[model samples]
Target: MYAYYGKEKIRMQPLHLLMERGHSCKLADIVKKCLRLDLLEKVTMKKNSALMMVVLLLMAVVLTGCASDDNQAATRTITDMAGNTVEIPASPQKIATMTGPSYEMVFMLGGKDKIGLVRSDHATGYPLALLTNSDLPNYPTIKGVGPQTPVNAEQFLDAGVDLVLYYNNAAELEKFKMAGIPAVVVNTTTTVPTTTEEYFEQSSANLKLLSEILGGEAVERYEKWYAYLTKNVELIAERTKDIKEEDRPVVYWGNTWGTNILSSYSRGTRDFEMELCGGTLVAPQEGGQFPEINKEQLLEWNPDIIFVDNHGNAPELVIEDMYSNKNWESLSAVQNKQLYRIPSGVFFMDKGSTNTLVLLWTAKVLHPDLFADIDMIKELQYYYSTFYDYDLSEEEAQKILEGWVDAENLVR
Candidate 1:
């Protein structure tokens, strides 16, 4: 018999040849020969079983390949602002922040629950922990955080913190990295912002970075806040931009605690606010360094309008000084009763809480005829509810315009 072997024909003896003529034949030839029906069925069944096993194994391999992506994304790596590469979970479950400004970012992002330690001993938590949010006042304050202070590694470990946020704290960031934890830097200005525009830029950057990490209502809230600021600021800018340089009001900003000069944000962000509101800074053309000027210098610059920061009740004495002092009586601001105190709520509005409110306030005060339609209280109500997630009643907003004292009882 001729059997096809690949493309060639080979002569082979049938299995029956051994039975019929007792001829020698190889096992291959025997298997190919028509011997018995039952034997043939058994051989075919064995080959089919082996083929089925191979098909099953291939299917499993393909399924595993499909699920590989999900398995790999269990963790991720990111580079922080300080250029430190860090490995973090795909979603952070535990978090800690070192500085107050960073904490402020976290708190606004609704990541307060993710925090490991409650806070560092120093708790400014700017624009974040408002007096309205009752929980912030009572959050546990971690002590011993300052210049030359080492991070408490055990706190992170014990609290199961997976991520830490610092403001340019390289040493502490390294400590977290060495301890098998990831720390990211959120750059905030320790120095004053030279201009209001720069201040907004930095603030928006911080907010956006935090939103990307937290991944929730943060982005929406931040966008709304940003839009709100831009709309009002642009309107103010348009009104003020074309004003003649000579016509711009000369303004002075004082940061005095009682009669004492604690510090001043001259030519700083707040000073820029005066300019954008159609006024000239008494001390302009400076950087983020809040330069100190004496009473004599202030007299030399006899500003048309004066704004005293409400920091440590400076407004109380500043207002009194303007009202009673003989030296101040010579100034136009004091004589015309333009000596006003900057407003505050959770924190000072002019300080850091929300400058949009103050910007609007300043613009209206500087050019009342141009900004007649603006309602400061309504804006504050929107800002508090929209940005901070706290409700600001009409009364509360009005109180915020005056000073922080009236808004002390506000709650989230």
Candidate 2:
């Protein structure tokens, strides 16, 4: 968390306190408070009526005094994929993050204090204190990504956020711009980045952009995160370098649905760690996307080891059903009993800061003979602490992963 001395304190809680004091607070007053804190640049109101303008100006004056940053804050205008120009705020105070994982990224980027509101689904695991506590104002929920529910422009407008962050197809910028919200789009949907360099570069660019939005001490803290991750990656690369290409195992990734989707170290939807650890995928099919292979293909390729992404406890039933079939038994991984469940916190998340850590930990796990000192639980606690600033006890982290497995069982 950033220091409490600045304008952040007002956005964080003082508004609720003012309301509780029996004074009816208006949004203009809050924006004034924001401006007084030097949080927002004063702009002439073109749409609001004169009466509203007086109230807003007063509020802006009050808020302008709240911002304490003495440094010359950085500002920039970046174009979205759709070519819309977005003028990013310097030290944005109230940011609405719509994408579920964008919340996680904001927290990782040291914008936890800057986050004014999060989408509903992202708030699922939020503690009661953030919402139910009378001392805090009720935060509005923005929309999320997926098929039916894309970004909600009205919700963004209603939130009055200075900036909005989400992960969506760049093509959806039109939907985003309709809200008149300056959005930062993190495109993680790209299933296959051409190379690991491209992947890290993209991820770092997102982090850098977010860090720029959250300047001052937040940027310093975020840099610490970058340093920590860089050190870890270097350690992982050096540790796994000894494992030769020929000696590396051919592994297949399985899910709870008894599906064996072949993975590769080279590129595509293949696990990123598999590539880092020199592991090759068995399926030799072209177009290395996540394709569902049948039992016949499983027998034909016969991967050396199987790593199930499913954290479900009794996924063994699905394993049993597959192994019971004669064709599945013919596979090398099935014959050797080398199949194991990959830890969910790392492999389970599709994309996030946690996903990157999972990649490092997975590289260590896949080549334990060469990287025997790898500690997944320790790594998890470190990532959670360093990035999210949330410490998880061993038991707690285990419960989350096991809980995921249990939930999958219930679904089955």
Q: All candidates' lDDT scores?
A: 0.63, 0.55
Q: lDDT tens digits, residues 1-412, model 1?
A: 3334345544433333222221122232343342356544433333565534533543443334435434545456676665667666666756676653466556656666666555532243322244556666555456666434788766666556667777576777777766556677765444455665775775466667767777777667667778877887888989998999888888887776556532566464555667789998777445443556767877888889887776545476768867798877888888898877787745556533376778888888888898999888888877777667788777777667766543222211
Whole-model alpha-carbon lDDT for candidate 1: 0.63
**Candidates' TM-scores?**
0.67, 0.66
State which candidate has the highest TM-score: 1
Query: Against the hidden true structure, what lDDT does model 2 obtain?
Result: 0.55
Best by lDDT: 1
The deviation in Å at residue 177 for candidate 2 is 1.2
lDDT of 2 by residue, 171-287 (tens): 555665554456776544444445656656655655566666676766776677677767766676677667777787887766444443333222354545566666876544444
Report how far residue 140 has shifted in candidate 2, in Å: 3.6
